[model samples]
Target: MTRFPLLAGAALLALATSASATSFVATTDTLGGLTANASESTSDISSSFDDDKIVRAARDDAASFVASNGAIRGAQLEAALRHIRQQAPQVQADDQQLARAILAL
Candidate 1:
């Protein structure tokens, strides 16, 4: 009946909204962790860590953060890009790799 259709539509909408909101939170957390790790790497580099080691560490941290949080989507990727630009300007290699991975997602 018409009531069935309306109920189904409402359920679908609710489910979609819930999924999107969860995705946003997960992506935000992942990106925030990446930004923090990048800042830490930058500090290590400034403190005389090898550039190659810093990049490697950052890449590993980013990968781990994404893996533990969830898969990134288009919107999440965009959020990460904006976050990187604002949060960690000095980040070069790690941020670049993270951006590429997010875009790939």
Candidate 2:
């Protein structure tokens, strides 16, 4: 019985090793024998977003969420504020301010 379990474990280990050996490697166009020119374009990225617009959007979304849910607290509040920070790092508002805004509704 103990020997049977050991044999089964060895068989599974062998099968896993063999399966891993045949596993496919994922490749993209860059890795598939194609050369792509890498260029950094600063204009389009910065020009597309206006600072005021981003701040306004964040505030509006927060207000709407607070209104719908009545309030943001605990993990939900932390996640929402984190999202706002990630979306607009340059925005002047801090987590405390955002939390107050959410609760003010």
**Highest TM-score against the true fold, candidate:** 1
Clashing pairs in 1: none
Q: What is the lDDT of residue 58 in candidate 1?
A: 45
Q: Write out the backbone clash pairs for model 2.
A: none
Model 1 ranges off by over 4 Å: 47-105
Give TM per candidate.
Answer: 0.43, 0.28
Off by over 4 Å in 2: 1-73
How many Å off is the CA of 90 in candidate 1? 17
Candidate 1: C-alpha lDDT: 0.56
Encode model 2's per-residue lDDT on 1-105: one tens digit a residue: 799999999999999987776563334544543322211111222232335343334555555555666354455555656655676565555454554444333
Q: Per-residue CA lDDT of candidate 1, range 1-105, in tens?
A: 999999999999999999999999999999999888866655544443233332333444455456655343344444554555455566564544554443232
- In order, candidate lDDTs are 0.56, 0.49
Alpha carbon lDDT at 82, candidate 1: 56
